[model samples]
Target: MKPEIFIQENIITIGQLLKKIGLIQTGGGAKFYLEKNKVLINNKKPEGRNSKVKNGDLLTINSNIYIVKKEQDI
Candidate 1:
């Protein structure tokens, strides 16, 4: 499947992004989920909900892919 794009500001935490994308009901849930699942960021499994994610970063969870993009002001 095609990767889903998440447009945000300068940056956001991994946990925050997960919640924003509806992967979790709350940011707190991200921590619990990450503990049992391996999420690949830029092709590497990064640990921590505080992991900084910026534009162009690729995240893969299970078989789904998410791409972070900076939202440009029109």
Candidate 2:
């Protein structure tokens, strides 16, 4: 099964999600990271740092896959 990331908010920006998952050291790094790395949301590239990621979304960073789930669901 893919790794799961539990979030309390209804939606989170891709930047925040990257930080929450420890993919980036800080939120500011998201911009540069996104430019250098391949990040896919539900099989497509994200719009940018501000792109929205919500419950049940699939996040792909490099070769890793993560599933977004609400905190209450766990």
Candidate 3:
């Protein structure tokens, strides 16, 4: 399923993504997930907590799939 949030910019941080997904209990929880390489951006593991995420990005966490794309008009 798709997330209710939208990615307007070409890039976003890993922490921001996790928080949006409701995976992280608090803002700091992102650090634990990232530190353990539990966060993957576009399949591969993220380089760091501040990794950039762009359009067409696919995020998989705890078996949950999140697609980031521009909101196109129907």
Worst lDDT run of 10 residues, candidate 2, spans 65-74
The digit string of per-residue lDDT tens for model 3 on 1-74 reads: 57634665667787876776576867787778887655567789877667877778887676666777756556
- Sum up the clashes in candidate 1: 0
Q: What are the Cα lDDT values of the candidates?
A: 0.81, 0.92, 0.72
Pairs of residues clashing in candidate 1:
none
Candidate 1 displacement at residue 1 in angstroms: 8.7
TM per prediction = 0.84, 0.91, 0.68
lDDT of 1 by residue, 20-43 (tens): 888899888988888888787888
Q: List clashing residue pairs in candidate 3.
A: none
Task: Give, for candidate 3, the lowest lDDT window spanning 10 residues.
Answer: 1-10
What is the Cα-based TM-score of model 3? 0.68
Clashes of 2: 0
lDDT of 3 at 26: 74
Clashes of each: 0, 0, 0
**1 against 2, candidate with superior TM-score:** 2
TM-score of decoy 1: 0.84
Q: Tell me which residue pairs clash in candidate 2.
A: none
